[model samples]
Target: MSDSLAEHVHYLGLANRSDLYRSAISDCIAPDDTVADLGCGVGVLGIFCLEVGASHVWGIDSSDAIYLAQETVRKAGLDKHYTCIASSTFRAELAEPVDALICDHIGYFGIDYGIIDMVRDAAKRMLKPGGAIMPDKLVLQIAGVSSDACHEKAAAWSDDIVPKVFHWIDEQARNTKYPHEFAPGELCSAPVELGQITLNADTPEYFSFEAEIEITSSGRFDGLAGWFKSHLGNDVWMTNSPLDPNGIKRSQAFFPIARPFDVQRGDRISVTIRARPEGNFLAWDITPRGGPTQKQSNWATTILAEADRATLDGPLRLNDNAQASQYILSLVDGQRTAAQIEETVMRDRPDLMPSQQGTRNLVRDILKRCAVS
Candidate 1:
């Protein structure tokens, strides 16, 4: 099977994940309620909404998996109650606001994949007053761990090996966060709650939190382990914590330090984590009470890049691509269907769009930028 199909298969097989969402959505939805499933993978959440008596469920996704989702809904005999839209939640518009908006965009650390910004936008424009936002809260926790396996992957670039992992990759590998499953004894320090995110609230562009973690066992402080408990609502929740037997086995986020340092029982380590400016961590500082500190940032890249400041800084002129796009968009004057517009564009602008598939892709991509219902 293809990777995309395999992914959806995996999603469908995640009984732990599906159960929580199913229960939570069932608790909140009524027979007359309309629901929106953003990033509706396999349409399972939307189907759960329908099964629980939601009136009309809209499942929006940007991938071609939308076709698979449509088929899934039809196969379940829920086509009449469901509508699958092949568009990004950022671009997809709903006709008449939904009574609730649900999404499964919570990343490993609970707040990655730009879900916060997307949910913030949806809450404002898509949901009705007091509309439910499932998994409204993400409770973050962190602990120090010792794992040769986890450290080796991040430190591999520094090894004197033949294939030559670039020296620059050392910075990126160590700085970037990873997902790991910690053995019961892997943790050197007792896990502590770091912070949380309420999905619908106005959150800061950058969120930072510091903690003093005390070691409970003797081991090398290889890195920090982070996980979250997502509150899906109505007493239903799921977590990726290593110790939770009932939680989803999705693992936890791990950040490898530059060097492995030794720590003993009762030793305190100071840690400060900065997350956001977009989903992932920007920087993390780990310092042993009386030893050296390891500080890393994802922003520090090896490549020298130029800033983009064209239309933002001054007068704008549309290029051929933008011009063709704008002219095709003009065809969507509230009377023509997307298919009608595509045929018109392919016929009228043979010079601009030579191939049929290319013309269709272009027209549909341009349509992704509009918020038409």
Candidate 2:
């Protein structure tokens, strides 16, 4: 495993936050119930289920951590009761329906990792008619925050650089989403529940939410701070909100405004958030009371320059690159193998395929993308 992934697994394995999950599993699992543990890192939750008297547990994870999960089950002498599948829970199939579905796919804020869609699909496919889902509901919370330190960290690339270079770098950074930690004192407004999703029911992949937050203190509004509250089971829940005294140690989402604005205690901040499950994109528009609206999206941070926007909006046509791709694709007539195609392309278009190794790589990439499975 990569060092980062190993460290992540190790940290999560030892996080005190996991105690909430263990307690919930112990309280919810029945003696004869079968559990499906999605994204089961080290099989900890699955083994906990077995220890709590679950009949069996199916642990699924797409990473190499699944092997460690299997090993953990064996070490616990519960190998006969736990089965680890080294595949994404979305793609894996179960022979029998499970009595409960357990997953810890929630990202830093809440739905950043596409857990909403994953859990919804698992409930439809692998869950029994009346099966329960851990963390049955999720609530997304948002509040206006005044944190010059956090804003400076995000906008660091804009300093001491040429205008064009800084714009490019800033654009790239804004396009990419990141989790940011916020100190309690940074909160400028009371939190508002933006949205909620019940995991046991079918849900749309796209969600739109709008909420108005009342500014509780006077400060500059630099961005919106976001967190999540997950209901694990009866009277068992976990949250990352700084306002929650019992909240876990987790990063919060900070959606920065293009420009900071001052606000008073009575001013209101209106927020509209649109979420796309496929790319985990979050688009937000903030309109402070009597202030101009500012729009930002996680996928594309800033509005493109006029010239760039015009070029992108222009009609599409095949260029020299497209013509070359067409020629290469024409060579795949189902009669010649990929090797033969590469040889012919190398001989005919040496300008595109300069080296034999490069030609092989180009052909392999083309086939991997265009070949019929």
Candidate 3:
């Protein structure tokens, strides 16, 4: 198995998240029912369903780790009730309709990692009529946060310790999105519901929402914090909200501002969010009431400056290897094997790739990038 997949399997083997999912699965599943476990890493969820008296479980994942999941089921003596498929739910064909579908595709703040599209597609195609999905409803909440700790971590690069390197790091921090942990006392305003997402056949692939939050405490506002609450069946649910006593332990979404602003009680902050299910891109705009608004988008951050563009558009300089990289990428057709590609690269550009071993490593790296499965 690949290192990345192994890391994921190790993470899923941890007790905290697995315990929560096991409890929810036991509550939602029924005897003599077929279950579809989407993105089933190591087949834990499907095995949990089988232990709860599920008739059969289909464990599907896109990674090669499905082989490990099959082995896990066999070792547990549950292979007769579980089938592991090493294919994405988008391309895999189900032999029979499932009575319920369960997936933990949620990311930080509950929108990233393309969960919405995956759940929507499975609900429409793989589930039987009236079939239920775990965490059927999701509500995203946003609040204005006053966190000196977070501000220090995000703006540390602005210090004059290392001028050139820190300046670039400061720019990157301002232009990037991050997952953060917020102390309850750091919240300057009560969380407001930003949006609600329902997983079903009628849900749209694109959505936009706006909300106004009233600040209840006086403090410095550096950015916004986002978390989600999910409604699993039988009144079992999980949330990461700061106010919830029984919420899951997970990071909240943090969108850093270019600069911090001081504010007083009764101040109002307006926020707008746009989400695209296709690429799981979320754009946010936050404005202090009567102040200038700032916009940040996960889809279009790190823009190139005009000066940099002009430099690239100028005459080709010596020792520039961008063309060689492009040529290597161009040869990544579906028909050519990695060995053939390595031989062609060695024969064509011996100066770029000197040794056979180096060419083989280069070909392997390029093929990994170009691989779709």
Task: Name the candidate that leads on TM-score.
Answer: 1
Candidates by TM-score, descending order: 1, 3, 2
Candidate 3 lDDT tens digits, 101-167:
9987777677776778888888888999999798688788999988987787668778667586547
Q: Which ten residues in a row have the lowest lDDT in candidate 3?
A: 316-325
Q: lDDT of each prediction vs. the true structure? A: 0.82, 0.81, 0.80
> Which digits, one per residue and each the tens of the lDDT, describe model 1 over residues 1-373?
2766887887667648888888888788878799988888678888888888899999998876788889988988889989999888988898889998888877777876667877888888899988888878888888998888888877877777825646767877787777788886888889999888898788888889898899999978898998889899879988988888887777678888887888899999999988882575457899999888889777654344343423467776877888987898788888887778878887888566667787778888887666264
Largest lDDT belongs to which candidate? 1
lDDT of 2 by residue, 1-373 (tens): 5753675565475435678888898889989899999888777778878888999999998776887877778987889999998788888999999999998778777888778888888998999999989978989999888887767765767866546555557655544456777788899888889999887877776889999999888978888889999999988998888877677878888888777888899898889989876436888899988888988886675556664565656677776667767888999888988878888988878666567677678778887667643
Instruction: Count clashing residue pairs per candidate.
Output: 0, 0, 0
Give the higher-lDDT candidate: 2 or 3: 2
TM-score of each: 0.83, 0.79, 0.80
Candidate 1, position 48, lDDT: 89
